[model samples]
Target: MSDTPCRVAVCWLLPELEQPARDLAARLQLPVATADSIEAELLLRLGGDGLSLQATGADAPGAVRVDFVEGALAHRRQFGGGAGQMVAKAVGLRGAVRPTVLDATAGLGRDAFVLASLGCEVTLIERQPIIAALLEDGLQRAREAGGEVAEIAERMTLIQGDAITFMAQWAAAAPQVIHLDPMFPHREKSALVKKEMRLFRPLAGDDLDAPALLAAAWALASHRVAVKRPRKAPSIDGPPPSAQLSGQSSRYDIYGKKKLG
Candidate 1:
């Protein structure tokens, strides 16, 4: 994991969210500040819309946050092929059964939400406190939106903790499929850089511990462990994957003790 310090604070951008912002600050042990008064380079902003992770440097990319209610997620749900999506197929969502999934490194929850929308009981584990806070805010917003979004949120359980520990503790009752997308080392920054990746790289560095994490998931996953990686990137050191499905930009290294029926 990257050893970078969190250069961020909780900022309340609206009067109504001030208390929630302050409460979040206290929970995160981060000082509360305003856009004008804050010294941190990034802000966990509580605004009229919802909580957003704001990049504050002169040339920084735009703010990034989880929004499963509308926007890209909605478009994906409406237009994107249902069980034919790469992630959906990777987690064995093709047949009649929608396997229970544990998304161990659920950074922004995009894939997990898709799985949940496709009818999987998904447990999301995020280790970073700030990211977890953002996810919680988004989930709360989606739940209150009260429609299909709320129903999807009902199928997702968020755990703000380490995936390995949780896997070990819940080994006997492991989910059918464990999905992992540990932070892969990225290419050089460019105009097309994934905004979320750029913002998250500093907070949660390269997944140097990815191999260990894969081992834990492999030990506990009842059906299989699906690992997402850069298409050309070599698999992290582990028992060789039973199969791999490659796409233009990414690949799924699938490991399983027994095949899902």
Candidate 2:
């Protein structure tokens, strides 16, 4: 993704959220308008479902929203394999050791949420303003929902800044684990990719600095750095992972800095 901040505007379909939308517009230094009038590449939509993104184009799909409490995240929390899952194991979540994790990429905050649900304190870093806003709104609504999901959301922190810069400044206070899930160029057809990916790819672009991100993670993580990759994709360009943990559709390339206690 580009290091430069993304340009976006706040749009509202529901009348009740207009003031809040205006407030966000002011904070983001963007204009407030309806989706149809939005001139920016990304439109932040405040609707009943929550904060979503609407890409401006002739062939763009409908607004895509982030819902932590009621969709895939909730399903995973309810029925996912918990600490036994691949990502959990990759982050060294075994026994009573719940390592603090910094998710460098934090796209949509899915893996971060999973780690948080498994009892890790996860700090999520998303550089893109639009994605960060959506993640922030999702976390807030999840917190207000007030249940297990809310409790999990409590352990998750969202940081709106470049991960590489954040890690560079975090050398002394590095977390036990740093997770990287940089977006790769999608080779599949647009119809084949997930809706969220379709929407996000246009906004975030390919993560061209992924190798640099890994290097920064190595410098910051006290214990290990775990990278998520498509099962069939090649390893990120850098030193080889110390080990790997694989699932059906994805794999975790683990670079060990120190063993987890």
Candidate 3:
């Protein structure tokens, strides 16, 4: 009965381990609906240590299923060095700056995970409660995913609030670089995009207000702000990028500001 339309329906696929789940849900401010057929905008699978989610399309926020933390850790390892460079670009907003990072739009938390993997303390800010719940569940799983990098995954922090609000409160520690990866509408709707993007599109909706997000990020980022856009698409507001990293279909626009020591 909250303003948020998406309801997190955790069907008991496994036995109930209520404390951690409930505690995590509370921490993330996600709505834990008791009814089985409450017409959830999203359906979340609450495991012992993590969560998996699929947008039900009625009112879900984004379509992403983060395997438990260990699963995520494996995925991170597989993502390999390309992801490492993405994290580097994020870190480089400060130009050799190793300042704390605030990932303003943490979709599936992939970028945040990468930043943490690269040894940067990451604070993830997500507005939607359901998405935050999935992230929390994923983080918990990552903690259990034992390997050389488990400790680095543990360094991530989740804050259940609007990025703008969090940035305002922590103005003093304004992140050296604020990373923004707002969801863009799929341009060429084909089987590939559908297979890969259908679920996420309904869940995240179109971030029509991405420009506002850019403005807020600029205000909060101390050294610079980097936005990931489809290679075909233009820059967020203008073409003032200090540098551009292009891929097959996406690009990273780095907007550098102050210099770092």
Candidate 4:
């Protein structure tokens, strides 16, 4: 990962978010400053649009933010097929039982949100402090928004720490399905990558410790472990998956320790 620190602060135009911004900065140990004041490689701005990241010298038109109440997340919640989507199938969501999921690598809480929308209780673990803060803020706003979105947000939990350590300590009380979506090295051109990917790649880097995470999942998950990877990327180094669910851009390698209901 780049040694450059990500400068984060609230957007000056939205003074109401300043307190929360300061709280976030304290939690992440990041310095708070105006967008133009810092000579940072990346600036994470918290405001009405939620938390967004912008490259200081990039020519991008807008910032990348995580908004669970609207945009892609809202669209997916409203229209996304429930318990029958590829992710649901990968998590073995069938019959009447909705497996409790431990999303070990909950980058933006996208997958975990999907699972929660499908009736599964999801615990999201994001090791990166900044990403976790963004996700937590989004969830908080989602809960206050009320209605179906709030209900789904209620089923999701967020934690900030290393997944391997968390799972190692919580193995005895582990959830039935443990989900892993470790970051992989993508070869796409910088400009061509999605804004979110472009912003997150520099912060989280590749998951060099994924194999260790997978092993810990195996030890903790009672029923199965699901690993999400690029469509053609090889599975994480460890025991082979028992089944596979393929999607257009990605695939789920399912390691079943026991039969699902």
Query: lDDT tens digits, residues 1-261, model 4?
Result: 333344444343488888877777777677777745656666677767677777766575467666788999888888888778888999998888899999999988999999999899999998887788778878988999999999999999999988999999993467999999988877654233677776777788788888999999999999999999988889999999999999998999999999877
> Global lDDT of each model?
0.88, 0.86, 0.67, 0.83
Give one digit per residue, the lDDT tens place, for model 2 in 1-261. 753344567888788999999988897777887746757766888888788888677877777766789977789988998998888999999899999999999989989999999899999999987789899999999999998889999999999998999988873567999999988776754334576776777678888889999999998899999999888888989999999998888899999988898
Q: Each model's RMSD to truth, in Å?
A: 1.7, 2.4, 4.4, 2.2
Judged by lDDT, which candidate is best?
1
Write the residue-wise lDDT of candidate 3 on 1-261 in tens digits: 124443545443455655655565576555554555355655565654356666666543554566534454457656666334655664573334466778888866877877777667888888766677677667766677777456866778888777766776674567878888887755665333442255445445667777778888887788888888887787887547888888776788888897655
Model 3: runs farther than 4 Å from truth?
Answer: 1-8, 17-41, 55-64, 68-75, 82-84, 93-97, 187-196
Clash count, one per candidate? 0, 0, 8, 0
Say which prediction, candidate 1 or candidate 3, comes out ahead on TM-score: 1
Candidate 1, residues 142-223: lDDT per residue as tens digits?
Answer: 9999989999999999999888888878834679999999987765743338788778888988888899899999988899
Q: lDDT, candidate 4, residue 228?
A: 96
Model 4 residue runs over 4 Å out of place are 1-11, 188-192
Clashing pairs in 2: none
- TM-score: the better of candidates 1 and 2: 1
- The estimated TM-scores of all candidates read 0.95, 0.91, 0.78, 0.92
TM-score top scorer: 1
